[model samples]
Target: MGQRLSGGSQLLITAFVHFQSSFIFIFQDYLEENSTSIYHDTVSIGGGSVFPQIQPQSRPRTESLDLNPESSLIVEISGAVSDKDRVLFTIHTKTTLPEFKHTECTVKRMHEEFIWLHNYLVEHDQYAGYIVPPVPPKPDFDASRAKLQRLGESEGSMPKEDLQKMKAELEAFRSLFLQTPKIWADSSEYLATFKKTVAMHEVFLQRLAAHPALRHDHNFRVFLEYEDELSVRTKTRKEKAADFFKSVSKTADEALRLTNQRDEDQFFREEKCLLTSYHAAVKDATAAADLANLQRKTMAENLLRVNLVLDNLVPKERLCTSEADLVSVLSSFFEGYQKIQVRLASDEDLKFSDTLRYYASDAGAAKDLLYRRSRALADYEAANRALDKARAKMKDIQAAEDAQFAANDRFKTISECARLELEDFKVRRIKYFQKNLVDFAELQVKHAKAHIDLVKSTLDRLRDIQPASSSSVMKEPTDSVGVPATERTVSLDDAFGSAVPFL
Candidate 1:
């Protein structure tokens, strides 16, 4: 395998390759015109003269001419200052280019400063609800030094072209806020104010750095490092929450399965059995009613034959009196039977089995609600466990490394917040289930009232058809078979025989 270059060297080589690619595009037209020659010595690949020098375009200076305090704010990063241990950057700002003095800074200090500027701008941008001009990234002093070392070059004796490129990049970085058209379009009024504020903040930071007492303070020196730890905690919290939701989603699916199973096992089974029993009772009742009607029609015909015989054979006055009495009894018996038979037929035809369906619905709803609550409780418990774990781990970390105490405190706060949210969810779920239970109870009461009213109506119908003892007493038929039409009188007790319990 071939030896690989370091990341720094690779970055420099990549930039070089990109520049060469652009050069190829620009020179392709010239090469096409001279295709007759297979080889050419004047084809400069680096920076020689395959192409003629082009004059630089002049741009009108847009910087303010007045030397006021706000307009005096300037910024630039000069080049690298390498040592045996680390590379330092030379920064220059706060005046016109000619008057600016260079200041040396380490990479770590510059990174912290850049982070401060970037974070402040981002926070303010969010508050204002618009984009702000962005700060340039910290200069890559170490990378530049490493690239130079790989090429057997020292910082003081770098390639002229590379030095020019670095200077150009720094110039662009300094002019980013003022020269970019996008910044002006985004928020014109805030641009100058933002620059002034950044300059003021930089001055304050410099003042703090100059103070002996505050220069070595942990709070001042470790802001960026602390922020990194906080960011890690935030990421971990989000991952835990995402995992919880994923697990709860699967629990919800399992709860749904349980709910459906309960419905099938309990209410659905009861409903099916109810329908089967009701239909069977109705069939048997209908058959009984048909038989009773047939018997009544036969009795009527027999009574009419007896009446005709009495009208022809007996003495006219006595026969007429006896015939009227017997006919009256027979008619009363037939009417009573018909009335009860009609009620039975109505009961069979109506088949009011809504109670069974209502119960099925109620049971299904209850099962679903119970299962949901069960799953929610499980999730709530899981959240509690997670919070406990976080708290325990935080305590361990806080004891293990004093530097992590602040991070542990933040994690503890996050865990407490999560716990509160879970408690609120549990409270809401309880309220919901309680309301459902109340509604279900009312539903049962309403069904019960309807059932009682049906029984009362049936009883009233039975009482209305009860025969009067003296007027419709039993009597023997004129035939010697000793049969009495009144003896066949149907009662409320007999009307419902073995066919009413399901109803």
Candidate 2:
């Protein structure tokens, strides 16, 4: 692995050097071009273009460390209340910072409010160098609700026991839907949506709190410390259209910038390539994980159907006593098995699959940071060219110099901050994966143990059952008809192996 990484690094360096040399020659040719033509064709400093001009801030002498020994901001989604189509999250903020109105406070925020905050951060020029956390997706329970409706429509055909057990499980889920109104309390769909949205929101807030600079943002403070509704409204059609076009322009600019520019910083160059590969790999992993979870749910549903069939069969008056007894045992076994399968699927989705999905978004955010820096670099180069043109033409020399200096300062600041942010990202990403993977493994072990116990108890119950007649009782099968006695016996290792083959 070390050798491979070293070789990749060498290739990257070689390519960068080659590109740099090629750019120098191309730039010399452009410089040699008639200054009059260049001056006439070049856009004015304030002219609208693909790359927006950024106003420079006073450059900091030293990069601020993402650490606070004296005080730390802690934020959490304490509870959530669900309205008809909206959820109000109770954001609890605790800190010792004097900047806040109170050291501790709680505020209610809706999903739209979260969107407002995320957009505020993204649009703010001050945060251009930072990897702003991705906006939490709007909570949508339409699919879950549709599934519930289907389940209700089919309830009559489903066995009474299975229906009751499923309802009971949903009710248990409702208990986790903290402070939800009675109207939405009984809804499995609402419960799931509430839990998922709350988790995403919590992660967003936690990330902001942990960031040294973002935690101090005035808008973030208001979001956490203010008690009333933020009164944020949805964007109008015109605004949405504008944003759409802006995003399209940005996409185009990113591709152009990447093609034309070679990152002078080796660290950023390697990070750019690493992030691209990581994002692709994570995306593929997420799809596979989702597919596996879907298959598990389907398996559970099929098991439930079989359990229902066995249950219906056991009650038939025509069936013999021994046959009914056998059907009853099988039905009971399947009931337990299906529940275990359902729980296992949910666990995997929450712990493993969601983690991968979240990191993929995070990786994208990191890549965006790189793109911003690249855009800054492009701007700096453009400013330098304009300055040279101004000097050659002896026109607006002071204005051109100011623009060049501002661009240079902005580029340096962004590059410095970006390096620190990416390093922190690497550490945080590793820690997050380790913790979640460990928790997932532990949960798998717990579920597998439960599964084995269920099988063992079912087997014991089957052995205790007596035949109703001689015809119903069969002698032990010979080696030719079935597995020999030694082969039939399963050790603990075999049980575990059978229960969780992936593990």
Candidate 3:
């Protein structure tokens, strides 16, 4: 506690003041307590304002009314620091003495030194002894609860036989795990080779699929061959699996890949073949369409020739017909060329997906399909034949119509020729038989005129004689008059073979 003596000085304005040697706590409790709270307020002594009241302390230590020579003053002090260690300092408040404040003095202001110096509860010589840092505890490893659980109930004790048996089992398991290294190595090598083979198979299938000819073949034949080869391979599980209680470690997808290897490959191959054939078929059909048009043009030309010949008076004939001759007449595209082409395509007998099917089943199916195709082709050929016959019949009808036209033309020509001849005969008859001979000559002219009529009638009769067959082929030959060449001359036989007495 800081010592102070308060007394009234009555004799003179000057009074004796004594500084106390007690331990002075240097920090202002009011300043320190309010150091963090209210700041110190300085007011002029002449101004007559008490420092805004610091919270009242427990009791007043001393009181004095000093109206001395210098000033009137009241000092209040509180602190926890021991004053013996610091030179006592004071701030002059209630006066115009700002220079008296401790903070007003600036020396070397080492920022933390002053506050920390104030924190000592006692002098450094009074501090007891050296402080030691606390040590952290060591961690336990073997004693871990997890290790105890791993040891199981056997941690405390176990029967020897059971112990022996477990030891033996562990030894046996370790041996078993190690025993097949050679076999495993061989299998590993085999698997490596198998992987390469599989890679080749995949590449081949990919190439086959990419082939322009094989895209749509649903069976994928080239891929199927790889599958067939895979099926023939060793499929037995590894011997190591028997020793292991662990269920086969292979996943379902791996097992399936191994198992269906051959089957998948087989399907791909068959489909490829079918796709190739279909590509070829499409190419063929286009060319066939063009050929068909050209044939129709030829047939039109031949028919036009027959039309022009009959326009004149010359008789149209099917001379020297033969049933077996090669006429070089073109086929209608569908019947002649296309039918042959479709047959060629059929003969390829390409087995696509169905080739992978059961042999008897595939054969039976093929046979049935073949039968249908053959029957259809046959029916088409028969229709083609019927069409050919109808076309030939048309020609015969046309020829007959042509012959009638020819006959009409001949009749007109013959009548015109006869009329002109008779006109000439009349002139001659009148001149040669001067009335006497005219009658005989006129009768001769009538006879000759009658013969001409008979010749025309014979020709008209021949034109009306329809042939038994209208085929382009016939062994018999006919002349331009449509009479058989070897036929007895109709005019000679009917008109002049014998002349009887006139009726």
Could you give candidate 2's per-residue lDDT for residues 111-214 as a string of tens digits?
99999999999889899899998889788866545645766897989767667656654654446544444322223333544566777788888778778889
Give candidate 2 misplaced runs (Cα > 4 Å): 1-71, 147-193, 316-320, 472-503
What digit string (tens of lDDT, one per residue) describes model 3 on residues 1-503?
01111212110101100100010122223334544232134553565454333331332212211112233222211111112222111111232233233222212211122222212211121211111101111112222233334346683596544443334223322332245321112122122222222222222223223333322232332212222221222213763455243324323422453323332233223433443464355345434533553354344334433323222211133233211011111111112332222222221111111111212222222222222222333334445455556567775555455545554454344334333433433353234225323333333334334443443443333333332221121123455698754423222114234322211
**Candidate 3 residue-wise lDDT at 422:** 32
CA RMSD per model (angstroms): 47.2, 23.5, 72.8
Assess the local accuracy of residue 18 in candidate 1 as a C-alpha lDDT between 0 and 100: 29
- Reference-based TM-score of each model: 0.18, 0.74, 0.13
**The 10-residue segment with the lowest total lDDT in model 1:** 125-134
The segments of candidate 3 whose C-alpha lies over 4 angstroms from its true place after superposition are 1-268, 312-503
By lDDT, highest first, what's the ranking?
2, 1, 3
lDDT of 3 at 338: 28
Model number with the top lDDT: 2
**Per-residue lDDT for 131 in model 1?**
19
In candidate 1, stretches whose alpha carbon ends up further than 4 angstroms from where it belongs are 1-54, 57-72, 78-91, 94-109, 124-127, 138-503
User: What lDDT does model 3 reach?
Assistant: 0.28
